[model samples]
Target: MKANNKRDVNVSKFDTATKTIHVFVALCDNQYQGIVPVPKTIGNGQDPDNNLYWGCANGIRSYFKKSKEWKLLKTQKLDKIRMERLVFKHVSKNYYLVADAYDGQYIKKTTTDFLYSAAGLLKDTIKINKTTIGINGNAKMVAYIGHDGLMDFQLNENFSNADGKQRDAIILACISKKYFAPHLSQAKANPLLWTTGLMAPEAYTLHDALSSYIAGGTADQIRTKGAMAYTKFQKCSLKASKNLLVTGY
Candidate 1:
């Protein structure tokens, strides 16, 4: 269904009879305007244009597609929206991954409609006719990636509709655990993995985490793998690695 903000949010069905896991990923926007700030000083300041926010979602899409474990099922690209639905099947396990990508306009808006739209999509799409381990049952997992920490107040103000689904969430944004976790947990979106400080929200960490998850890694293990991936690929310092956080196992 489409939200009032004109951004499209679509979710694929999860068949309980098949025992498949359906993952719904909402990537808010592709712009870096508000996410990475322009430096007031020229010589010693970092280039705001060098930010990776513009390519975060696309990087994730590429990471999944390039992986041998995931197969790209379909793709949709429009002026304001882009989506990719993928699947992973190994032996007796199967997983469905859906990613809905938004344009930069939504993030520039003054309203929290983007977050509301994402939450609405999550609540609408993730269902359980039976029981499964990481979704609607006992071991559900959800993740929010991108630069939304600057809109923390709006996110907290508008993000409040819970359908009583227990989920383990990973928010890969700046200070995600500090700013977004409380409200998310309060709304029944339990936090399993998150960040405590500024983060680039790179795709490798998420890719590694999902890889570990698909390989039967626990939440903590997934976090560790993600941190290691970030350090290895992104060349992050030890201080940056310490920003990764976990809660409730």
Candidate 2:
């Protein structure tokens, strides 16, 4: 896949003493092509105003903005890259948050290509020589929120730098646990938090999971909290909540 010259990216440091780096990647809006078909209730509903398209991404951003625990460090819009990068630091904690938003159109068979590419770019940017964040080791967490199962992509090789880094992952997408856990585990990303059957990419669910992680919740707690949040807000059947799963926790 060819790289788009137009991309928006930003980074900031909250604390140099912190040993963990959190990465969040929210893919392009739902209007992008190659979006997997979701249930009408969560996808193309009778009311267009209330849909799951980009709901997870928007929700996660809103949570950070409203929370006192997180302080905005920097915000940059790189119009040339078609991506927006937001960095935050946890108040009274040694954790830095890096969130990336891709605004370009999603290309089929190349979405993951861009996803890993963006991650690689961020990793390179945070290396000791590149930034003053004092990042001397690998990241502690890397979370991805966006469409999944629409296409297949390799994860093992893309994140080789994180091998044995004990970096946990929280993926908010349909059947993420089923489809992504194995590859992420093989790549040495431990204790993945994901879901099993079909699921609506709702913001509340992602918020809960992320909240749990911020609170130092274990992988099981993240999955449980996220499932419960989905059940409470989406009003879906209990079976939907049962679909949340954890591995390598």
Candidate 3:
């Protein structure tokens, strides 16, 4: 509950016609996070230049930059907790993607922020050209990508819905469905895509899922897209991938 010195953008003054997708990614840290250790070079969370979940080939930033459907619009350096931010616009859709790379040491904060967004408690906006994009609570979809910190720590506060916005949520973490179910239910957010068991939280899954979402796919279709991406990249069976990545309760 420390004071948040950061200021939220005045969303009322800007254009709110475009849809947005906000993604919160916690960098991989071998030292600070609780999990099987990764190679030191890529596991240094503070070093985003080579971090496993931020700058690596399969990471969100790099993967999205290479995607044909998304065009990188901006990159900004943030504070200590949120190390970096990147904004992208979908090529053929009126949608914006805002992604934050949280330092691995602040994974708890990232998790809290994601939950806050899902519950419509964290309202933040950004300006892109003439459009003002809602990157937090006002976003159409909120996504979390990183280690399942819920497995290591417990959250005492309830993430109840604050505005009844009913945002869609995508959690790309190990066993995310089980860990995030109760909180997501309390937040009144629709479970668009989440995991049932341990899996690699890579960018391909999210990239394809978002593609399907942009194509106006339903929740089940989005989940199927994610499963197909996982199966293709991880070399796992489509059935196993479908079982691992599921939608709904």
Candidate 4:
């Protein structure tokens, strides 16, 4: 068996539509330096951590900070990828979605290889925080109904187990009307303000849902309920100033 090195690593990674969160670290002379965050400024002042990207940034930082085998090289932000605006007549099928922020396209309808995208940009958005204790994301709803949380509805333990299967079921619940919004009090006012129809992608990848939002309306501007975000994208030119960019960023 190969021995695993726990202390350090050096690698390039993509973290945004404009660039990857690429960082290199090593243990050359046995000294330590703090980890580097991304350049949220993109083209301006000192880089901000907001752009290091979430989810994958944590462990990657921890790995190099402790390892004695890796060292920092260079972190480069790529030209933004521009993807083709994807429109779903009715979400007839699932397809791959890619980012193209810098290239000018911003989005590509990978499903066209098959067919379809979003039908709405309405913002009844729900984000599941799985990092919470047993059954994060209020996913227990699946088990509460008396199912196994997976293959069976009665297996309640699975929902509280953090088992991969349980997580999948919980995510599926978010997209369904079954996961009704509890009366979350006023404190949860809204950080993703002005952004509509923003659903967490789960294992699907955020790139899949970007265009839906990049094309939708703001919380304060939701003139139409049940209005589709994708169709809304068509209402405004890509050049139209979006008030939601402040929150989405």
Candidate 5:
């Protein structure tokens, strides 16, 4: 913003793509004495949709934009990598888990093929792809990450709306969520239908549903994360024959 409390702001991720928060840095202004920046929401519009980003009376926009600190806060930055790649790619592929840095997590692999996919998922992060899940675990505890679809959360947004054959695919997504909620008794813990895609309903109270879920987390100790919190696995690793993996949408 300029000195007279006026500044032009473009409201789009691309608009601010170059903007990054550095550790131990801050952007401060006088109007709103000690303003804290609220991270903008990630969009869920299918190729082209957006919620409005307007200014608040007390220069809410100006203050938050100007105020920043050196270190990023916990919960400060939400939605890192996702889970679709985990369930569809590795587990569905029968691959093993290798490390991934972009998501600051891991991918999967076991044999050479599985190893290679995991390698691609983390090609930039690691050199040699050597990893596998040595410890046996229950499939019930496994979680799959899906790409963001909350904007289309309404039941009307069906498979054909997706980029693929999508009939079975869309049904599977809805079924998966419904399945996990009851099976794991985690209807409450489900991450937003999309990850880091929207703000809490603007006027809701803390006791409102979002607050509760955010506080305790969605009930499972070993809950599955579908969109943001889930793991990235490939399906083919499981089959002796190669197959296509449709990561969740």
Candidate 6:
């Protein structure tokens, strides 16, 4: 795996004081993606303000911003591939969350970036309150949210673990346990939360799981929190949600 050309040598400087969570969200695309089509208005990937995964009522930005645990810090417009970025800080914990919304057309890049981050091959830094914080590969937890691009295309790049340090990963895609198994193992990441079958990849599940995670809950406990959230929002049975939202290999 290739590392970022301009690396931040001081990325680990604040590791003891703060932890980072980096999330890559591929905006929902009705035309470019292979999933069953959604309504035209919200499925437009280029328009992050209305995209299903980024801007909708249940989207990451909207939902996380409304949470009492996370305080929205900054919002920035990025380049073409990555449309927007949101930074949030935990109100009670020394944790920072950075989420990037990738253009719908660049789902492949989003998936690749998540895998690279999980492998600890792509490290980067961001400044908050004049303090440099590690992101990407330096994040303690890396997550991929949106359509399962692996179901549409294959990746040729090797995502082997670049650093021996183990990181936690959350994949909120349909049947991710099956499709992401090989690459995830190669990346040597612990699966904190993932799905087993086709399901909606919404923000509630991630938010709830993080709530438990921040409270020092075990993997199974965190998974239960996510499952309960999914059940509450999706109006599904607890058994079904539990089966869908799983943790571990």
The model with the greatest lDDT is 6
Q: Report lDDT per candidate.
A: 0.49, 0.52, 0.90, 0.19, 0.18, 0.91
Candidate 2 vs candidate 3: which has greater TM-score? 3
Maximum-TM-score candidate:
6
Candidate 3, 56-143: lDDT as tens digits: 9999999999999999999999898899999999998999999999999999999999998898777877788777778778789999
After best superposition, candidate 6 residue 27: deviation in angstroms?
Answer: 0.1
Candidate 2: clashing residue pairs, number:
7
Clashes of 1: 3
Q: Provide C-alpha RMSD values for all models, in order.
A: 7.3, 6.6, 2.3, 21.1, 20.8, 1.4
Off by over 4 Å in 4: 1-180, 183-217, 220-249
Order by lDDT, highest first: 6, 3, 2, 1, 4, 5
lDDT of 1 at 42: 16
- The alpha-carbon deviation from the true structure for residue 141 of candidate 4, after best TM-score superposition, in angstroms, is 21
Candidate 4, overall lDDT?
Answer: 0.19
For candidate 3, give the lDDT: 0.90
Deviation in Å, model 1, residue 152 alpha carbon: 6.4
Error of 3 at 220 (Å): 1.3
- Stretches off by above 4 angstroms in model 2 are 1-16, 19-21, 28-32, 36-58, 104-122, 125-131, 134-137, 149-163, 237-239
Where is the poorest 10-residue window by lDDT in model 3?
1-10
Question: Each model's number of backbone clashes?
Answer: 3, 7, 0, 42, 42, 0
Task: Tell me how far the alpha carbon of residue 65 in candidate 5 is from the true structure, in angstroms, after superposition.
Answer: 28
Candidate 3 regions with alpha-carbon error over 4 angstroms: 1-9
